[model samples]
Target: MLSFNIYLYCGGNISMKMAFRPTDGWRWYFDREYDSLMLEVSSDMLFRSCYPSKMLIPDVFSEFSFSVSDAASYYQFHNCCHSLNLTESQKIQLSINGIVAANFLKPQMPKSWYFSQQSTEYTPKVADIVKVYMQEDGLEVCMMVVEVGEHASLCIIAQPTFFSMNKTFYFSEAIKVMNDRLALAQQFAQPDNSIVLDDEELELKAIS
Candidate 1:
Protein backbone atom coordinates (compact mmCIF):
# COMPACT_ATOMS: atom_id res chain seq x y z
CA MET A 1 0.00 0.00 0.00
CA LEU A 2 1.27 3.48 -0.93
CA SER A 3 0.31 6.83 0.62
CA PHE A 4 0.78 10.46 -0.40
CA ASN A 5 0.89 13.92 1.14
CA ILE A 6 0.08 16.78 -1.21
CA TYR A 7 1.66 20.20 -0.92
CA LEU A 8 -0.43 23.18 -1.89
CA TYR A 9 1.17 26.61 -2.09
CA CYS A 10 -0.66 29.92 -2.43
CA GLY A 11 1.13 33.24 -2.04
CA GLY A 12 3.55 32.53 0.83
CA ASN A 13 1.55 29.87 2.65
CA ILE A 14 1.80 26.10 2.20
CA SER A 15 -0.67 23.39 3.21
CA MET A 16 -0.35 19.61 3.06
CA LYS A 17 -3.16 17.12 2.49
CA MET A 18 -2.91 13.45 3.32
CA ALA A 19 -4.23 11.17 0.57
CA PHE A 20 -4.74 7.44 1.00
CA ARG A 21 -3.99 5.07 -1.82
CA PRO A 22 -5.22 1.54 -2.25
CA THR A 23 -2.37 0.35 -4.39
CA ASP A 24 1.05 1.13 -5.87
CA GLY A 25 0.84 4.18 -8.18
CA TRP A 26 1.90 7.83 -8.68
CA ARG A 27 0.06 11.12 -9.16
CA TRP A 28 0.75 14.88 -9.20
CA TYR A 29 -1.71 17.81 -9.17
CA PHE A 30 -0.96 21.51 -9.66
CA ASP A 31 -3.14 24.52 -10.17
CA ARG A 32 -3.12 28.35 -9.83
CA GLU A 33 -3.73 28.19 -6.09
CA TYR A 34 -0.94 25.71 -5.38
CA ASP A 35 1.04 22.79 -6.70
CA SER A 36 0.30 19.31 -5.37
CA LEU A 37 2.50 16.22 -5.59
CA MET A 38 1.81 12.63 -4.55
CA LEU A 39 4.14 9.65 -4.71
CA GLU A 40 3.88 6.03 -3.62
CA VAL A 41 7.34 5.27 -2.25
CA SER A 42 8.80 2.55 -0.09
CA SER A 43 10.68 2.62 3.18
CA ASP A 44 13.98 2.28 1.34
CA MET A 45 13.36 5.53 -0.53
CA LEU A 46 15.65 8.51 0.04
CA PHE A 47 15.01 12.21 -0.08
CA ARG A 48 17.65 14.49 -1.66
CA SER A 49 17.89 18.25 -1.61
CA CYS A 50 18.94 20.22 -4.66
CA TYR A 51 20.35 22.91 -2.38
CA PRO A 52 24.09 22.75 -1.99
CA SER A 53 25.27 21.26 1.31
CA LYS A 54 28.66 20.14 2.52
CA MET A 55 27.32 17.69 5.07
CA LEU A 56 28.73 14.21 4.55
CA ILE A 57 25.69 12.51 6.10
CA PRO A 58 24.72 11.54 2.50
CA ASP A 59 21.12 12.54 3.19
CA VAL A 60 18.19 11.66 5.42
CA PHE A 61 16.81 8.48 3.88
CA SER A 62 13.91 7.13 5.88
CA GLU A 63 10.16 6.32 5.71
CA PHE A 64 8.40 9.52 6.63
CA SER A 65 6.72 12.64 5.29
CA PHE A 66 7.74 16.29 4.93
CA SER A 67 6.84 19.46 3.10
CA VAL A 68 8.87 21.80 0.88
CA SER A 69 9.36 25.25 2.36
CA ASP A 70 10.54 27.49 -0.47
CA ALA A 71 9.88 27.42 -4.20
CA ALA A 72 13.57 28.10 -4.86
CA SER A 73 14.49 25.06 -2.80
CA TYR A 74 13.88 22.03 -5.01
CA TYR A 75 14.68 18.36 -4.47
CA GLN A 76 16.07 15.34 -6.30
CA PHE A 77 14.74 11.93 -5.28
CA HIS A 78 15.24 8.32 -6.42
CA ASN A 79 14.47 4.72 -5.38
CA CYS A 80 17.20 2.35 -4.23
CA CYS A 81 17.72 -0.84 -2.24
CA HIS A 82 20.71 -0.90 0.03
CA SER A 83 22.69 -4.00 1.04
CA LEU A 84 21.66 -5.60 -2.24
CA ASN A 85 24.34 -8.04 -3.34
CA LEU A 86 24.04 -8.82 -7.03
CA THR A 87 26.04 -10.41 -9.86
CA GLU A 88 26.71 -9.27 -13.43
CA SER A 89 23.82 -11.36 -14.77
CA GLN A 90 21.48 -10.31 -11.94
CA LYS A 91 19.29 -7.23 -12.05
CA ILE A 92 16.95 -5.52 -9.59
CA GLN A 93 13.44 -4.62 -10.72
CA LEU A 94 12.58 -1.22 -9.25
CA SER A 95 9.30 0.74 -9.03
CA ILE A 96 8.47 3.77 -6.88
CA ASN A 97 5.59 6.04 -5.95
CA GLY A 98 8.09 8.65 -4.75
CA ILE A 99 11.86 8.22 -4.18
CA VAL A 100 14.36 5.82 -2.60
CA ALA A 101 17.99 5.48 -1.42
CA ALA A 102 19.79 2.35 -0.30
CA ASN A 103 23.24 1.32 0.91
CA PHE A 104 25.17 -1.72 1.98
CA LEU A 105 23.90 -3.28 5.19
CA LYS A 106 27.11 -5.08 5.94
CA PRO A 107 30.72 -3.98 5.89
CA GLN A 108 31.92 -6.94 3.79
CA MET A 109 30.79 -9.27 1.03
CA PRO A 110 28.02 -11.92 1.25
CA LYS A 111 26.96 -10.91 4.73
CA SER A 112 26.89 -7.27 3.67
CA TRP A 113 23.83 -7.78 1.50
CA TYR A 114 21.31 -8.04 4.33
CA PHE A 115 18.55 -5.57 5.13
CA SER A 116 18.57 -3.53 8.31
CA GLN A 117 16.65 -4.37 11.50
CA GLN A 118 13.88 -1.95 10.54
CA SER A 119 12.98 -3.17 7.05
CA THR A 120 11.94 -6.84 7.22
CA GLU A 121 8.43 -6.92 8.70
CA TYR A 122 7.67 -3.52 7.22
CA THR A 123 4.00 -3.72 6.36
CA PRO A 124 2.71 -1.87 3.32
CA LYS A 125 1.93 1.59 4.60
CA VAL A 126 0.61 4.55 2.65
CA ALA A 127 4.12 5.24 1.31
CA ASP A 128 4.95 1.61 0.73
CA ILE A 129 6.02 0.63 -2.82
CA VAL A 130 6.74 -2.64 -4.62
CA LYS A 131 9.96 -4.37 -5.79
CA VAL A 132 10.69 -7.51 -7.78
CA TYR A 133 13.82 -9.54 -8.59
CA MET A 134 15.30 -11.01 -11.79
CA GLN A 135 18.38 -13.15 -12.14
CA GLU A 136 20.07 -15.40 -14.69
CA ASP A 137 20.56 -19.13 -14.31
CA GLY A 138 23.56 -20.69 -12.48
CA LEU A 139 23.69 -17.84 -10.01
CA GLU A 140 23.83 -18.88 -6.39
CA VAL A 141 20.75 -17.72 -4.53
CA CYS A 142 21.31 -16.28 -1.06
CA MET A 143 18.88 -15.49 1.69
CA MET A 144 18.05 -11.86 2.50
CA VAL A 145 17.48 -10.61 6.06
CA VAL A 146 14.68 -8.07 6.06
CA GLU A 147 14.22 -5.85 9.12
CA VAL A 148 10.56 -4.88 9.26
CA GLY A 149 10.63 -2.49 12.16
CA GLU A 150 12.35 -2.13 15.54
CA HIS A 151 12.43 -5.84 16.22
CA ALA A 152 13.97 -8.89 14.55
CA SER A 153 14.67 -9.50 10.88
CA LEU A 154 13.01 -12.03 8.58
CA CYS A 155 15.31 -14.27 6.60
CA ILE A 156 13.94 -15.19 3.17
CA ILE A 157 15.27 -16.78 -0.01
CA ALA A 158 14.44 -16.19 -3.65
CA GLN A 159 11.60 -18.09 -5.27
CA PRO A 160 12.13 -21.09 -7.55
CA THR A 161 12.56 -21.03 -11.33
CA PHE A 162 9.16 -19.75 -12.42
CA PHE A 163 10.42 -17.71 -15.37
CA SER A 164 12.96 -18.57 -18.04
CA MET A 165 14.08 -17.13 -21.36
CA ASN A 166 15.87 -18.53 -24.43
CA LYS A 167 17.67 -21.89 -24.34
CA THR A 168 20.21 -20.59 -21.86
CA PHE A 169 18.18 -22.23 -19.05
CA TYR A 170 19.26 -19.42 -16.75
CA PHE A 171 16.37 -20.00 -14.41
CA SER A 172 17.19 -23.67 -13.89
CA GLU A 173 20.86 -22.99 -13.30
CA ALA A 174 20.00 -20.27 -10.83
CA ILE A 175 17.69 -22.62 -8.94
CA LYS A 176 20.32 -25.32 -8.82
CA VAL A 177 22.81 -22.91 -7.36
CA MET A 178 20.21 -21.73 -4.86
CA ASN A 179 19.41 -25.30 -3.82
CA ASP A 180 23.07 -25.90 -3.17
CA ARG A 181 23.14 -22.88 -0.91
CA LEU A 182 20.05 -23.78 1.13
CA ALA A 183 17.50 -26.45 0.26
CA LEU A 184 15.18 -25.27 3.02
CA ALA A 185 14.95 -21.74 1.59
CA GLN A 186 13.71 -23.10 -1.70
CA GLN A 187 10.99 -24.89 0.20
CA PHE A 188 10.04 -21.71 2.04
CA ALA A 189 9.43 -19.71 -1.13
CA GLN A 190 7.46 -22.47 -2.82
CA PRO A 191 4.26 -21.53 -1.00
CA ASP A 192 4.93 -17.81 -0.61
CA ASN A 193 4.50 -15.33 -3.45
CA SER A 194 6.37 -12.06 -3.85
CA ILE A 195 5.71 -9.22 -1.43
CA VAL A 196 2.34 -7.62 -2.03
CA LEU A 197 0.75 -4.28 -1.19
CA ASP A 198 -2.50 -4.84 0.74
CA ASP A 199 -4.66 -1.74 0.79
CA GLU A 200 -8.35 -1.93 0.03
CA GLU A 201 -9.39 1.69 0.52
CA LEU A 202 -6.80 3.25 -1.78
CA GLU A 203 -7.53 2.83 -5.47
CA LEU A 204 -5.01 3.14 -8.29
CA LYS A 205 -6.18 5.70 -10.84
CA ALA A 206 -4.68 6.81 -14.14
CA ILE A 207 -2.67 9.99 -14.02
CA SER A 208 -2.83 12.43 -16.92
Candidate 2:
Protein backbone atom coordinates (compact mmCIF):
# COMPACT_ATOMS: atom_id res chain seq x y z
CA MET A 1 0.00 0.00 0.00
CA LEU A 2 1.11 3.54 -0.73
CA SER A 3 0.96 6.14 2.02
CA PHE A 4 1.26 9.91 1.63
CA ASN A 5 1.12 12.83 4.06
CA ILE A 6 -0.44 16.21 3.29
CA TYR A 7 -0.44 19.28 5.57
CA LEU A 8 -3.45 21.60 5.97
CA TYR A 9 -2.62 25.28 5.45
CA CYS A 10 -4.01 28.55 6.81
CA GLY A 11 -2.59 32.04 7.41
CA GLY A 12 -1.99 34.23 10.48
CA ASN A 13 -1.01 32.98 13.93
CA ILE A 14 -1.93 29.26 13.72
CA SER A 15 -3.91 27.61 16.46
CA MET A 16 -5.70 24.25 16.89
CA LYS A 17 -9.40 23.94 17.77
CA MET A 18 -11.19 21.07 19.40
CA ALA A 19 -14.95 20.37 19.23
CA PHE A 20 -16.54 19.37 22.46
CA ARG A 21 -19.70 18.76 24.46
CA PRO A 22 -20.10 20.21 27.94
CA THR A 23 -19.61 16.80 29.47
CA ASP A 24 -16.85 15.40 27.26
CA GLY A 25 -14.55 17.31 24.96
CA TRP A 26 -13.23 16.37 21.47
CA ARG A 27 -14.85 15.92 18.07
CA TRP A 28 -13.40 13.94 15.17
CA TYR A 29 -13.40 15.03 11.52
CA PHE A 30 -12.39 12.94 8.53
CA ASP A 31 -9.92 14.27 6.00
CA ARG A 32 -9.92 12.25 2.77
CA GLU A 33 -6.41 13.27 1.77
CA TYR A 34 -4.76 11.85 4.88
CA ASP A 35 -7.28 9.03 4.84
CA SER A 36 -11.04 8.87 5.05
CA LEU A 37 -10.41 9.11 8.79
CA MET A 38 -10.72 11.78 11.49
CA LEU A 39 -9.03 11.77 14.87
CA GLU A 40 -10.42 13.19 18.14
CA VAL A 41 -9.83 16.64 19.67
CA SER A 42 -11.53 19.29 21.82
CA SER A 43 -14.30 21.53 20.43
CA ASP A 44 -12.78 25.00 20.51
CA MET A 45 -9.89 24.09 18.18
CA LEU A 46 -9.47 26.54 15.27
CA PHE A 47 -8.09 26.38 11.68
CA ARG A 48 -9.58 26.64 8.21
CA SER A 49 -9.71 24.17 5.32
CA CYS A 50 -6.81 26.02 3.69
CA TYR A 51 -4.29 27.98 5.75
CA PRO A 52 -0.80 26.51 5.91
CA SER A 53 1.24 27.78 2.97
CA LYS A 54 4.25 25.52 3.58
CA MET A 55 4.78 21.81 4.15
CA LEU A 56 8.02 20.42 5.54
CA ILE A 57 8.97 16.74 5.32
CA PRO A 58 10.97 15.48 8.29
CA ASP A 59 13.51 12.63 8.39
CA VAL A 60 12.06 10.51 11.20
CA PHE A 61 9.61 8.39 9.17
CA SER A 62 9.87 6.90 5.68
CA GLU A 63 6.36 8.22 5.16
CA PHE A 64 5.60 11.95 4.96
CA SER A 65 6.17 14.11 8.05
CA PHE A 66 5.48 17.70 9.12
CA SER A 67 6.34 19.78 12.20
CA VAL A 68 3.81 21.84 14.18
CA SER A 69 4.20 24.06 17.24
CA ASP A 70 2.25 23.90 20.46
CA ALA A 71 1.25 26.17 23.36
CA ALA A 72 4.42 25.41 25.28
CA SER A 73 7.77 24.53 23.79
CA TYR A 74 6.41 21.16 22.63
CA TYR A 75 6.42 20.25 18.92
CA GLN A 76 4.67 17.45 17.04
CA PHE A 77 5.81 15.62 13.91
CA HIS A 78 2.90 13.62 12.50
CA ASN A 79 3.54 10.48 10.43
CA CYS A 80 1.08 8.29 8.56
CA CYS A 81 0.85 4.51 8.48
CA HIS A 82 4.04 4.20 10.51
CA SER A 83 2.85 0.77 11.59
CA LEU A 84 0.60 -1.84 9.98
CA ASN A 85 -1.72 -2.90 12.82
CA LEU A 86 -2.97 -0.83 15.78
CA THR A 87 -5.97 -1.61 17.92
CA GLU A 88 -8.83 0.80 18.41
CA SER A 89 -8.36 3.71 20.87
CA GLN A 90 -4.62 3.22 20.66
CA LYS A 91 -4.20 6.89 19.76
CA ILE A 92 -0.97 8.74 19.14
CA GLN A 93 -1.34 11.80 21.33
CA LEU A 94 0.25 15.05 20.18
CA SER A 95 0.32 17.51 23.06
CA ILE A 96 1.58 20.20 20.74
CA ASN A 97 -1.22 19.90 18.20
CA GLY A 98 -3.76 18.89 20.82
CA ILE A 99 -4.94 15.90 18.75
CA VAL A 100 -5.09 12.15 19.32
CA ALA A 101 -5.81 9.19 17.03
CA ALA A 102 -5.14 5.58 16.17
CA ASN A 103 -4.76 5.48 12.40
CA PHE A 104 -4.32 1.70 12.35
CA LEU A 105 -6.06 -1.46 13.42
CA LYS A 106 -5.23 -3.99 16.13
CA PRO A 107 -7.14 -7.22 16.89
CA GLN A 108 -6.52 -6.80 20.60
CA MET A 109 -8.76 -3.72 20.61
CA PRO A 110 -12.20 -4.24 22.09
CA LYS A 111 -15.41 -4.35 20.07
CA SER A 112 -16.91 -1.62 22.23
CA TRP A 113 -13.92 0.51 21.47
CA TYR A 114 -15.16 3.91 20.29
CA PHE A 115 -12.37 4.54 17.82
CA SER A 116 -13.03 1.17 16.17
CA GLN A 117 -16.33 2.40 14.75
CA GLN A 118 -14.41 4.49 12.23
CA SER A 119 -11.02 2.78 12.55
CA THR A 120 -8.92 2.38 9.41
CA GLU A 121 -6.26 -0.19 8.50
CA TYR A 122 -3.25 1.95 9.39
CA THR A 123 -0.93 1.60 12.41
CA PRO A 124 1.75 4.17 13.26
CA LYS A 125 4.99 3.32 15.09
CA VAL A 126 6.31 5.40 17.97
CA ALA A 127 9.95 5.15 16.94
CA ASP A 128 9.24 6.54 13.52
CA ILE A 129 7.02 9.26 15.02
CA VAL A 130 8.73 12.33 16.50
CA LYS A 131 6.99 14.13 19.37
CA VAL A 132 8.51 16.79 21.65
CA TYR A 133 7.03 17.61 25.02
CA MET A 134 8.24 19.30 28.22
CA GLN A 135 9.82 17.02 30.78
CA GLU A 136 10.94 17.85 34.29
CA ASP A 137 12.33 14.39 35.09
CA GLY A 138 12.99 13.41 31.46
CA LEU A 139 10.53 10.53 31.64
CA GLU A 140 9.41 9.64 28.15
CA VAL A 141 5.66 9.59 28.16
CA CYS A 142 4.81 6.23 26.66
CA MET A 143 2.54 6.65 23.68
CA MET A 144 -0.83 5.11 24.52
CA VAL A 145 -3.33 3.51 22.12
CA VAL A 146 -6.71 3.40 23.76
CA GLU A 147 -10.28 2.65 22.60
CA VAL A 148 -11.57 6.08 23.65
CA GLY A 149 -13.49 7.77 20.88
CA GLU A 150 -15.68 10.88 20.47
CA HIS A 151 -18.04 9.67 23.08
CA ALA A 152 -16.53 7.49 25.76
CA SER A 153 -17.01 4.32 23.67
CA LEU A 154 -15.72 1.62 26.00
CA CYS A 155 -14.70 1.87 29.63
CA ILE A 156 -12.05 4.62 29.61
CA ILE A 157 -8.86 3.93 31.48
CA ALA A 158 -8.36 7.13 33.41
CA GLN A 159 -4.77 7.61 34.45
CA PRO A 160 -3.00 10.43 36.28
CA THR A 161 -0.46 10.92 33.53
CA PHE A 162 -2.46 12.41 30.61
CA PHE A 163 -6.14 11.72 31.15
CA SER A 164 -7.69 14.35 33.38
CA MET A 165 -11.01 14.38 35.21
CA ASN A 166 -11.25 18.14 34.90
CA LYS A 167 -12.92 19.30 31.71
CA THR A 168 -9.82 20.63 29.97
CA PHE A 169 -11.87 22.86 27.64
CA TYR A 170 -10.49 21.03 24.62
CA PHE A 171 -10.25 23.45 21.66
CA SER A 172 -11.15 26.83 23.10
CA GLU A 173 -8.38 26.89 25.64
CA ALA A 174 -5.84 25.62 23.16
CA ILE A 175 -6.80 28.17 20.50
CA LYS A 176 -6.57 31.03 22.95
CA VAL A 177 -3.13 29.88 23.93
CA MET A 178 -1.94 29.40 20.33
CA ASN A 179 -3.21 32.76 19.11
CA ASP A 180 -1.36 34.50 21.88
CA ARG A 181 1.92 32.83 20.96
CA LEU A 182 1.98 32.98 17.11
CA ALA A 183 2.45 36.12 15.05
CA LEU A 184 0.16 36.78 12.10
CA ALA A 185 1.96 36.86 8.81
CA GLN A 186 1.35 39.90 6.62
CA GLN A 187 -2.14 39.79 5.17
CA PHE A 188 -2.55 39.57 1.44
CA ALA A 189 -5.53 40.51 -0.72
CA GLN A 190 -7.38 37.59 0.84
CA PRO A 191 -10.57 38.14 2.80
CA ASP A 192 -10.43 38.90 6.52
CA ASN A 193 -12.81 36.14 7.66
CA SER A 194 -10.63 33.29 6.38
CA ILE A 195 -9.51 30.74 9.01
CA VAL A 196 -5.84 30.25 9.87
CA LEU A 197 -3.74 27.07 9.80
CA ASP A 198 -2.40 25.15 12.74
CA ASP A 199 1.15 23.78 13.31
CA GLU A 200 0.26 21.23 10.65
CA GLU A 201 -1.44 22.59 7.55
CA LEU A 202 -4.78 20.93 8.30
CA GLU A 203 -7.73 23.31 8.68
CA LEU A 204 -7.99 24.39 12.32
CA LYS A 205 -11.57 23.21 12.71
CA ALA A 206 -11.95 20.66 15.51
CA ILE A 207 -15.71 20.32 15.30
CA SER A 208 -15.48 16.59 14.91
Candidate 3:
Protein backbone atom coordinates (compact mmCIF):
# COMPACT_ATOMS: atom_id res chain seq x y z
CA MET A 1 0.00 0.00 0.00
CA LEU A 2 1.84 3.10 -1.20
CA SER A 3 0.77 6.41 0.30
CA PHE A 4 1.62 9.76 -1.39
CA ASN A 5 -0.18 12.62 0.28
CA ILE A 6 2.56 14.89 1.64
CA TYR A 7 0.11 17.23 3.35
CA LEU A 8 -0.61 14.27 5.59
CA TYR A 9 3.09 13.74 6.31
CA CYS A 10 3.33 15.86 9.42
CA GLY A 11 0.66 13.90 11.29
CA GLY A 12 -2.10 14.33 8.71
CA ASN A 13 -2.74 17.46 10.68
CA ILE A 14 -1.33 20.23 8.52
CA SER A 15 -4.12 21.44 6.32
CA MET A 16 -3.73 23.16 2.94
CA LYS A 17 -6.22 25.87 2.11
CA MET A 18 -7.34 26.12 -1.47
CA ALA A 19 -6.19 29.52 -2.61
CA PHE A 20 -6.04 28.53 -6.25
CA ARG A 21 -7.40 31.25 -8.48
CA PRO A 22 -7.91 29.78 -11.91
CA THR A 23 -9.25 32.74 -13.72
CA ASP A 24 -10.63 33.30 -17.15
CA GLY A 25 -8.24 34.26 -20.02
CA TRP A 26 -4.97 34.98 -18.13
CA ARG A 27 -3.10 32.71 -20.51
CA TRP A 28 0.18 33.44 -18.72
CA TYR A 29 1.35 34.14 -15.18
CA PHE A 30 1.45 37.79 -14.29
CA ASP A 31 3.89 37.33 -11.40
CA ARG A 32 5.20 34.95 -8.72
CA GLU A 33 6.41 35.15 -5.13
CA TYR A 34 10.01 34.02 -5.31
CA ASP A 35 10.48 33.87 -1.57
CA SER A 36 7.50 31.64 -0.85
CA LEU A 37 7.52 29.62 -4.09
CA MET A 38 4.02 30.75 -4.92
CA LEU A 39 2.97 30.50 -8.55
CA GLU A 40 0.33 31.83 -10.94
CA VAL A 41 -0.90 29.79 -13.83
CA SER A 42 -3.25 30.12 -16.76
CA SER A 43 -5.87 27.89 -18.33
CA ASP A 44 -3.37 25.18 -19.04
CA MET A 45 -3.09 22.16 -16.77
CA LEU A 46 0.57 21.98 -17.81
CA PHE A 47 2.41 24.98 -16.48
CA ARG A 48 6.05 25.20 -17.48
CA SER A 49 8.67 26.93 -15.37
CA CYS A 50 10.81 29.68 -16.80
CA TYR A 51 13.61 28.95 -14.33
CA PRO A 52 16.31 26.59 -15.50
CA SER A 53 16.76 23.24 -13.71
CA LYS A 54 20.05 24.45 -12.16
CA MET A 55 18.29 27.42 -10.59
CA LEU A 56 15.54 25.35 -8.95
CA ILE A 57 17.42 23.16 -6.55
CA PRO A 58 16.67 23.34 -2.78
CA ASP A 59 14.18 26.09 -3.46
CA VAL A 60 11.80 25.75 -6.34
CA PHE A 61 12.61 22.05 -6.66
CA SER A 62 11.82 21.65 -3.02
CA GLU A 63 8.46 23.26 -3.60
CA PHE A 64 7.74 21.28 -6.72
CA SER A 65 9.54 18.17 -5.40
CA PHE A 66 11.56 16.20 -7.94
CA SER A 67 14.75 14.11 -8.26
CA VAL A 68 16.45 12.44 -11.24
CA SER A 69 19.37 10.19 -12.16
CA ASP A 70 21.86 9.74 -14.98
CA ALA A 71 22.82 6.40 -16.48
CA ALA A 72 25.36 5.37 -13.84
CA SER A 73 23.35 6.10 -10.69
CA TYR A 74 20.28 4.67 -12.35
CA TYR A 75 22.07 1.36 -12.66
CA GLN A 76 23.41 1.70 -9.14
CA PHE A 77 19.93 2.02 -7.61
CA HIS A 78 18.63 -0.91 -9.64
CA ASN A 79 21.66 -3.03 -8.88
CA CYS A 80 21.81 -2.04 -5.21
CA CYS A 81 19.81 -5.10 -4.37
CA HIS A 82 22.77 -7.12 -5.73
CA SER A 83 25.96 -5.06 -5.85
CA LEU A 84 26.09 -2.84 -2.78
CA ASN A 85 25.48 -3.19 0.91
CA LEU A 86 23.57 -0.19 2.19
CA THR A 87 23.35 1.26 5.65
CA GLU A 88 20.03 0.80 7.42
CA SER A 89 18.78 4.26 6.48
CA GLN A 90 19.29 3.74 2.75
CA LYS A 91 17.11 0.68 2.81
CA ILE A 92 13.88 2.52 3.61
CA GLN A 93 11.79 5.28 2.02
CA LEU A 94 11.54 8.35 4.24
CA SER A 95 9.12 11.24 4.28
CA ILE A 96 11.09 14.19 5.51
CA ASN A 97 9.57 17.21 7.32
CA GLY A 98 12.88 18.91 8.07
CA ILE A 99 15.97 20.57 6.73
CA VAL A 100 18.68 19.47 4.26
CA ALA A 101 22.17 20.67 3.39
CA ALA A 102 25.08 20.39 0.94
CA ASN A 103 25.76 16.82 0.00
CA PHE A 104 22.40 16.02 1.48
CA LEU A 105 22.86 12.37 2.36
CA LYS A 106 26.27 12.64 0.81
CA PRO A 107 28.85 9.89 0.22
CA GLN A 108 25.62 8.33 -0.93
CA MET A 109 24.03 8.95 -4.32
CA PRO A 110 22.69 12.42 -5.08
CA LYS A 111 19.49 13.56 -3.33
CA SER A 112 17.67 13.24 -6.64
CA TRP A 113 17.86 9.46 -6.50
CA TYR A 114 16.00 7.87 -3.60
CA PHE A 115 17.34 4.50 -2.40
CA SER A 116 14.83 2.02 -1.12
CA GLN A 117 15.94 -0.75 1.25
CA GLN A 118 13.62 -2.75 -0.87
CA SER A 119 14.16 -3.27 -4.62
CA THR A 120 12.84 0.05 -5.92
CA GLU A 121 14.20 1.10 -9.29
CA TYR A 122 15.26 4.63 -10.15
CA THR A 123 13.48 6.27 -13.06
CA PRO A 124 15.60 6.91 -16.17
CA LYS A 125 14.85 10.55 -16.95
CA VAL A 126 13.99 13.84 -15.29
CA ALA A 127 10.86 14.40 -17.33
CA ASP A 128 8.87 11.54 -15.85
CA ILE A 129 7.40 13.10 -12.73
CA VAL A 130 4.47 10.91 -11.72
CA LYS A 131 5.70 7.49 -10.71
CA VAL A 132 3.42 4.82 -9.26
CA TYR A 133 4.62 2.16 -6.84
CA MET A 134 3.03 0.16 -4.08
CA GLN A 135 4.02 0.75 -0.49
CA GLU A 136 4.61 -2.66 0.99
CA ASP A 137 4.06 -1.35 4.49
CA GLY A 138 0.71 0.13 5.37
CA LEU A 139 0.98 3.74 6.45
CA GLU A 140 0.22 2.72 10.01
CA VAL A 141 3.26 0.42 10.22
CA CYS A 142 6.65 2.01 10.79
CA MET A 143 9.56 1.20 13.07
CA MET A 144 11.08 4.07 15.03
CA VAL A 145 14.83 4.18 15.51
CA VAL A 146 15.72 7.65 16.75
CA GLU A 147 14.32 9.53 19.70
CA VAL A 148 13.01 13.08 19.69
CA GLY A 149 15.57 15.81 20.59
CA GLU A 150 18.43 13.50 19.72
CA HIS A 151 20.86 14.77 17.10
CA ALA A 152 22.24 12.58 14.38
CA SER A 153 23.73 13.34 11.00
CA LEU A 154 20.82 14.59 8.95
CA CYS A 155 19.90 12.11 6.27
CA ILE A 156 19.05 13.53 2.85
CA ILE A 157 15.40 13.02 1.95
CA ALA A 158 13.15 14.36 -0.82
CA GLN A 159 9.55 15.24 -0.01
CA PRO A 160 7.28 14.64 -3.02
CA THR A 161 6.08 18.20 -3.61
CA PHE A 162 5.68 20.93 -1.07
CA PHE A 163 8.76 22.44 0.50
CA SER A 164 12.34 21.35 1.00
CA MET A 165 13.31 21.85 4.61
CA ASN A 166 16.83 22.83 5.67
CA LYS A 167 17.40 19.71 7.81
CA THR A 168 16.23 20.79 11.21
CA PHE A 169 13.41 18.71 12.70
CA TYR A 170 14.35 15.55 14.61
CA PHE A 171 13.74 12.02 13.36
CA SER A 172 11.34 11.24 16.18
CA GLU A 173 9.40 14.37 15.35
CA ALA A 174 8.91 13.20 11.78
CA ILE A 175 7.71 9.64 12.42
CA LYS A 176 4.02 10.19 12.97
CA VAL A 177 3.90 12.90 10.39
CA MET A 178 5.45 10.78 7.66
CA ASN A 179 3.24 7.80 8.40
CA ASP A 180 0.06 9.82 8.45
CA ARG A 181 0.99 11.67 5.30
CA LEU A 182 1.95 8.39 3.66
CA ALA A 183 -1.46 7.05 4.44
CA LEU A 184 -3.09 10.18 3.14
CA ALA A 185 -0.84 10.39 0.11
CA GLN A 186 -1.52 6.71 -0.08
CA GLN A 187 1.43 6.24 -2.34
CA PHE A 188 4.51 6.96 -0.37
CA ALA A 189 1.82 5.34 -1.28
CA GLN A 190 -0.68 2.88 0.06
CA PRO A 191 -0.44 -0.88 -0.49
CA ASP A 192 -2.06 -0.72 -3.91
CA ASN A 193 -0.91 2.65 -5.27
CA SER A 194 2.33 4.02 -3.78
CA ILE A 195 3.07 7.45 -5.27
CA VAL A 196 6.73 8.34 -5.55
CA LEU A 197 7.52 11.93 -6.60
CA ASP A 198 10.32 11.21 -9.00
CA ASP A 199 11.09 12.85 -12.34
CA GLU A 200 11.59 9.67 -14.28
CA GLU A 201 9.84 6.37 -14.93
CA LEU A 202 11.43 2.99 -14.28
CA GLU A 203 12.96 1.42 -17.38
CA LEU A 204 14.35 -1.94 -16.37
CA LYS A 205 17.35 -3.25 -18.24
CA ALA A 206 18.67 -6.77 -17.94
CA ILE A 207 21.64 -6.72 -15.58
CA SER A 208 24.82 -8.35 -16.72
Candidate 3, lDDT over the whole model: 0.22
Best by TM-score: 2
lDDT per residue as tens, model 3, 9-89:
211221123332224332322123322222222222222222223322443344332233222322332232221122222
- Estimate TM-scores for all models: 0.18, 0.21, 0.20
RMSD of 1: 17.2
Clashes of each: 24, 42, 37
Candidate 1: worst-modelled 10 consecutive residues by lDDT: 171-180
Stretches off by above 4 angstroms in model 2 are: 1-9, 15-26, 39-141, 145-208
- Model 2, range 80-135, lDDT digits (tens) per residue? 21231221111122322222222222212232211112212223222122111112
- lDDT for 144 in candidate 3 is 22
TM-score between candidate 2 and the true structure: 0.21
Evaluated against the true structure, the overall lDDT of model 2 is 0.23
Cα TM-score of candidate 3: 0.20
Q: What 10-residue stretch in candidate 3 is worst by lDDT?
A: 176-185
Instruction: Count backbone overlaps in model 3.
Output: 37
Cα deviation at 4, candidate 2, in Å, is: 11
Which stretches of candidate 3 lie above 4 Å from their native place? 1-24, 27-38, 41-109, 112-117, 120-208
